[model samples]
Target: MQIVILNDAAAVAAYGANIFATQLQKKPTSVLGLATGSTPVALYQELIAKNKAGEISFSQATTFNLDEYLGLTGDHPQSYRHFMNEQLFSHIDINKDNTFVPPGDALNPITACKEYEDKIVAAGGVDVQLLGIGRNGHIGFNEPSSGLRSRTRVKTLTKATVDDNARFFAADEYQPQLSITMGIGTILEAKKVVLLATGENKADAVRAMIEGPLMAACPASALQLHQDAVIVIDKAAASKLADLEFYQHIEAENQKLQAHLATL
Candidate 1:
């Protein structure tokens, strides 16, 4: 596990984009595990701009989204599928068919979940996964108490989660009560993962994820066990972290070392 604290949100987003860009440069056809929400919108925008400038090309890249709200279809205005298209896919050169978001309205969700996991395997697993940590320390709708080794499956959203998401829907639209998310175990399978958090609102969760004990109550903490997992956040989000200065020094020294090694 590694920590990167930037001055603010825009810087965080750019750094996140650079992670993806570097991966794409090395493997243009890499499979990406993507996330949604306000936190990643800026990162997606940065990526889109890079594609427009020819700095990067995702034409051959494949993408798998983290989760989708149950009862909403791909075409639904607020569905994750629509969110991906509007936020990133539509603006990039990537083939629309290469992107995969879980079927939100699958009649037989049991089969759908299994097939979703199979698709990731068929793609040879994710090269990198982008993530956003909820204020409650949840990742991919895998709320508190969710099993760390679970797979892609249906999960009932906690009332706290639904209440937190209420602002995303119209007054009359019901907040999602359930969702299909790649479980903690499934997420850990990615070769690399970058988890982003920003603003003071996420400070507590950020601290818990990076420093707190590894328990199911804080699912994001599971990233500690991943071979390559990094936490990227802004100053405010990282405010609660106790080893703030040490994290900065370590990241800087590692970068210097990597630069030195590249010439060898």
Candidate 2:
């Protein structure tokens, strides 16, 4: 449950990109868990910059996206598949064959969910997972009340998630009521996890995830139990944290250690 308070959203994104680059350096074919939403847009941009600089190459990497709207086709403007293409896939060198997004339009969504999890297992599991929290603390589309051990499955979206995601669609009516998402159990299997939050809208959720009880009410709180999870937030999003200075000191120490390792 490490927290990093960045000076701004760009700093958060830069740090996240560095983390991704570090993983790719260690394992050229690393399996990456990706997420959609405004919170990760800047991070994707930073990744693109790294790719352009030849600092990192995603050509051999495999990607598994967290979720997709159940009824939406891949071409739908509001679909997570489309969102990933526009935000990331198009700009990166990764092969299309190595990327997987849950089949949103599958006639049998339950089967599709099971197969999605199976695909991840066959790919050797995710090395690192990127997450964005919903306003209600949902991860992927696993809303509140989702069991900790739940597998990939179809989930009904809460009205708040619909509203928060409505901006991507032409109208609220276009938002899908159901989504297929990786379960918290699946996410916890990743070797490392990075969750990002920016803006004041996320402040309360960030505080609850870090300081509040690990109740199902806030699904992101489950990260508290993960051994290598990092929550990188901008100042605005970290506003509700009580021990802000303590977190900063810890990040500074981590930076010093990283620098020492690099010199060695």
Candidate 3:
């Protein structure tokens, strides 16, 4: 895992956006794995700006979201599909038909889960997966203790996760207690993975993921097994990491090496 600690959230977002922009530039037909929530909003906005400026295009890109609330329809304002459309897709040149999110209203959820997995494989797997870690170290709704080698499937939401998401719903609005999510095993299959986190609230989770032992207790720790996983975060989010300075030094050395190669 490459730990990239930036000065602030804005810088973190820009760095993350640049990664995607570069990927899209290199492979216009890239199969992207996307994520939702407040953390990734800025990055999505940056991509939209790039699209508008002709710096990048998603016209041929196909996307699959990490997860969705189990009880909501695609048309529902709270649904992940609607969230993607409102935040990224509607503003870009991508074909909506090519973007896939697990069906929340599937008549047979089990079969739907299998179909979701198959579609991903048929699309050539995710070239790069963008993710945002929850405060509890959960990724794609695979909460604490989630199987490290599980597949796409239905999952029960922990109380902490439900409470964390409660802010998104109105006081009397319905909040889903279940979700369909891509599992840790599925995520590790991606050729590259980029995860972003910000704020002091995520510090513990970030530390646990980057420094703790690889265990199912911290779902995000699964990224450690991936050959190309990048963890980007603001200083606040990386505050709890013990080898923080070493990580920064490593990134600096990597940048210098790339620059040197260009000169050669």
Which tens-of-lDDT digit does each residue in 99-144 have in candidate 1? 9998999999889999999999999999999999988899988999
Q: lDDT tens string, model 3, 1-264? A: 888999999999999999999999999999999999899999999999999999999999999999999989999999999999999999999999999999999999999999999999999999999999998899999999999999999999999999999998999999999999998899999999999999999999999999999999899999999999999999999999999999999999999999999998
Worst 10 residues of 3 by lDDT: 1-10
Clashing residue pairs, backbone N/CA/C < 3 A, model 1: none
Local accuracy by lDDT, each model: 0.94, 0.91, 0.96
Q: Sorted on TM-score, highest at the top, how do the candidates line up?
A: 3, 1, 2
Task: Kindly report the root-mean-square deviation of model 1 from the true structure over all alpha carbons.
Answer: 0.9
Give per-residue lDDT, candidate 2, residue 64. Answer: 99
Off by over 4 Å in 2: none
In candidate 2, what are the lDDT values of residues 135-198, reduced to their tens digit? 7888888899888877899989999998898787775366688899999999989999999999
**In model 1, which range of ten residues has the least summed lDDT?**
167-176
Runs off by more than 4 Å, candidate 3? none
Question: In terms of lDDT, which candidate is strongest?
Answer: 3
